[model samples]
Target chain A: GAGVSQSPRYKVAKRGQDVALRCDPISGHVSLFWYQQALGQGPEFLTYFQNEAQLDKSGLPSDRFFAERPEGSVSTLKIQRTQQEDSAVYLCASKRTGRETQYFGPGTRLLVL
Target chain B: AQSVTQPDIHITVSEGASLELRCNYSYGATPYLFWYVQSPGQGLQLLLKYFSGDTLVQGIKGFEAEFKRSQSSFNLRKPSVHWSDAAEYFCAVGPKTGAGSYQLTFGKGTKLSVIP
Candidate 1:
């Protein structure tokens, strides 16, 4: 793809429902990242991956939030028992390698009602 | 640990006026810095980045930033503001890493409002 692509650009889920967001990073990109952006706020780092290895999950807010990059090119972020507070835009980014500037996707706007 | 702070939550500038957005970061060693812009309802787009070498770095859209180690700041500046330049600007610092780790710490963005 030309750039990072995220699925379900807009999602509305009832409270307590589980939702999954997907990301397809640039092909062969060595580094991928996930971020959460609340309304009127900047994106906050959630997790990072180097190839198929999940090197950093320190930014995941809680056990309810989980992410995986099984094949290294595609990633999924799962939120269990979503709450209203989970309403925010989920962003995915990719970089050619670590320590480089990231290219972001259009983001998935999740609205937990 | 690494963190970023964008003091001005909102800034309004007239078209053709010079613009500046303040950013401060905290990290132990030399940190990689970046600035990104997000237009309304769009994804984040990289403005500029500073890794090493010169303190002043030029970026797209006629934007530039200076990294000051002593002040722990990397402020984005543009000589003239355009109406199309109105957007949310973010400042980010890369987390400490060895070789294959990639993480970004971002500050609450400053919203740039252009007044024509």
Candidate 2:
């Protein structure tokens, strides 16, 4: 079975540029999550979605960070005017309904120069 | 708010040696604890989780964690660690919600270096 997968495994962007990271969760997964991991640090929650509805986005750092799962399957995390501080590995995870374990994706490594 | 702590930033152990990784968490209520492993350039892999019931929980790759509510700790251990066990270990606490969401607050991680 395919686990969660993210597109653009590596992204290099200049400051002030915008980037979009995509995540494809497992088929039939009802819950999706996004997290950011800095160098030598653990992943931090960014946003969560239950189907097409985003339930928690409190972990989004700023307005520049926005995510949406419009069709209830694929989700996108967009960063506007990318900054050096926004450089990190963005991870995606998904889980089945009524399950607690989360399967993670390989993640997109974003580097803002 | 809610937070997790991995006291050891790094640990070195010889292959076939017993190993233990410390983790502690703070939450207002009963917390859901988890352990995850990450290899270089890889996604986080679930090792084990303790939501309730038995304090001792077993996971993949011969890993286990003991959740101690009195100490607010969930430490991961292995009877004998293999060289492949060298990786970054993370401790996380999931705040229970009425909606049954699994949002995790993670620790800084402990890097394990296994010696041959």
Candidate 3:
């Protein structure tokens, strides 16, 4: 079975540029989550979605960070006007409706120069 | 809100030696606890979790954890560790509420090194 996967595994962007990171959750997964991980630190929650409805976006750092899972499958995290502090790895995870565990994607590593 | 602590930033062990990783959490009630392993350029992999019932819980790759409510700790252990076990370990905690279970707070992570 294919686990969650993220695109643009490595991205280098100039400061003030906009970047979009994509996530493909597992088939039939009802819960999806996004997390940000800085160097040598654990992942921090960013947002969560149940199906197409985003139930939580409390962890998003600022207005520049936006996420959408319109059709209840693919998700995208867009950062507008990237800054040096925005450089980090963005991870996606998905869980089944009745499962307590979440499967994670390899993650997208973004570097803002 | 729940927070977890991994006291050891790094641990070095010889192959076949026993391994134990300490984890402590701060929460008002019994929280949902988990251990995850991450290799370079890979996603976090679930090692084990503690919800309720018996304190000891078993997980994949010969890993086990014991939840101690008295100490607010859920430490991961293995009888004998393999060289392949070298990776970063994370301890996470979440509220026990119905809706808050999905929001996990993770620790700083402990890097494990195995000498063959």
Candidate 4:
């Protein structure tokens, strides 16, 4: 694709329900990343992948948050037992192996009520 | 842990006026710095970055930023502001992991409003 793409531009989930967000990175990009942005705040790192290898996931807020990139080209972020505090925008980004710039997706706004 | 700070919550500049947005960062070692702009309902667009070499780095859309190691600052500037330039600006610090992957730490962001 021309740029990173995320699915389900918006989501509404009841508290305690599970939600899964998806990301499709640009073709041939070797690095992928996930971030969470709260209302009126900058995006915060959640996890990173280098060609299917989960290199780092230190920024994930809690055990309920999980992410995977089994095939390297696509990724998913799943949140279990969603809470009101889980309301935020989930962002995905990807970049070439030798590049510093990461192309971002439109983001998925999740609202837990 | 590295962190970024965008001191100004909001800034209003008239069209054709010079503009500067302040940023500060905290890290034990030299860190990669970046500036990104975000319009409403849009993803962030990179404005500039500083990894090494000359302090002043130029970016797209007539944007530039200077990295000052002494003050731990990377300030974004433009010679003339445009109404189209109104957006939210974020400052970020990249802390390279052991494998060289950059996990970015971003500031809250400064909202820029341009007055025509």
Candidate 5:
């Protein structure tokens, strides 16, 4: 695709529910990133993937947040037992290389009730 | 720890007036600074970045930023403001690169409101 794309632009989940957000990065990009942005705040780093390798997961907020990229092209971010505090905009970005600029996608806004 | 700070939480500018958004950072070495704009419910759009060489870097959408190492600042500027430019602006700092290391630390962002 021309740019990074995220699915389910918005999601409303009840507390303790599970939800999965998908990210389709630009073709042939070697680096992918996931971030979480709370209301009125900057986007915080969540995880990173260089192709199929998941090198950094230090930024993940808790154990309930999981991300995976199987073939290196697409990725998924799953949050289990969602809580009200978990509500935020989930953003996905991709870079041509590790040192290049990242292209971001329209975030998926998740609301937990 | 590396971090970026945007002092102003909200700024209002009149249309056709000059604009400047302040940003400061704390990093060990030469920092890769970036400016991004985000409209409501939209994705972030990169305005400009500073990697090396020239301290003054030009970006898309008639925006520019200067990286000042002495004060540890990278401020974004525009000659004239437009109503369409009203949005949230973010400042980010990150490392150049190395395998298994690619993360960007962003500021809380400045909300820009343009007056007609």
Candidate 6:
């Protein structure tokens, strides 16, 4: 009954610093998604994975944003040389195979100073 | 490209009053629509989703939504809203890609405020 969970609920990074956000999806979930949400805005898709395969990375803003799900369970979103424009909440969601509904995690709030 | 729109940026309603939140979407085909609620510092919670068949779908917390194909709209409603219903509501559309994958596009979100 465990839902998706993210680590470092709050992260404060200086400009030009790199940060890594972690996510743990539900057990047996085959599909994972990452989204970015700005203040007073809805979440926007960033990337998607299906069992260790990165299916979609089109939503990623730039080369600085990279994600990987190596073992098909845990996922990590990395941002290199964090910038003020990159400050936002990063959310993780997971869904079972053949299911449309996705369960979301608490999200990691990243602030660039 | 698929997109969702929430016309109302904010709505205020009294407790026990009926409530309705408007949502519109634009897609090439019949898209999968969903309503999600989010509290402050929390993740999104699914309210209801409309795929096919019935135009009316019921969800948790006494929430319901009606999908109108002609209008390209999926509006959320409740007969009587509780104070706890005050939160941010989002409308999203999911479109299937050529690779057999699905991607969701969400609206700007509507903030609901309840008064006693």
**Which numbered prediction scores highest in DockQ against the true structure?**
5
Tens-digit lDDT track of model 1 for B1-116 = 67899999999999999999999998888888999999987999999999999999999999999989899999999999999999999999885457535578899999999999
Weakest ten-residue segment in model 6 chain A by summed lDDT: A1-10
Better of 4 and 6 by DockQ: 6
Chain A TM-score vs. truth, each candidate: 0.97, 0.98, 0.98, 0.98, 0.97, 0.99
Best by TM-score: 5
**In angstroms, how far off is A112's CA in candidate 1?**
0.1
Q: Estimate each model's TM-score.
A: 0.96, 0.97, 0.97, 0.96, 0.98, 0.98
Per residue, candidate 4 scores C-alpha lDDT tens digits across A1-113 of 98889998999999999999999999999999999999999999999999999999988999999999998889999999999999999989998876677878999999999
Residues B1-116 of candidate 6 have per-residue lDDT tens digits of 78899999999999999999999999999988999999999999999998889999999999999999899999999999899999999999987434445778999999999999
Worst lDDT run of 10 residues, candidate 3 chain B, spans B94-103
Report clash pairs, candidate 3. none
CA shift of B8, model 3, Å: 0.5
Residue B113, candidate 3: Cα error in Å is: 0.6
Better of 2 and 4 by TM-score: 2
CAPRI level of candidate 6? medium
- How does candidate 1 fare on TM-score? 0.96
Candidate 1 chain B minimal-lDDT segment of 10 residues: B94-103
Quality of candidate 6 docking, DockQ: 0.79
TM-score of 5: 0.98
Better candidate number, 2 or 4, judged by lDDT: 2
lDDT of each: 0.92, 0.93, 0.93, 0.92, 0.94, 0.94
In angstroms, give how far residue B58 of model 2 lies from its true place: 0.9
Give the per-residue Cα lDDT of candidate 2 at B52.
Answer: 86
Task: Give DockQ per model, in order.
Answer: 0.76, 0.77, 0.76, 0.70, 0.83, 0.79
Worst 10 residues of 2 chain A by lDDT: A95-104
Which digits, one per residue and each the tens of the lDDT, describe model 2 over residues B1-41? Answer: 88888999999999999999999898988877889999999
Residue range A1-113, candidate 1, lDDT tens digits: 99999999999999999999999998888889999999998898899988888898988999999999998789999999999999999999998954477999999999999
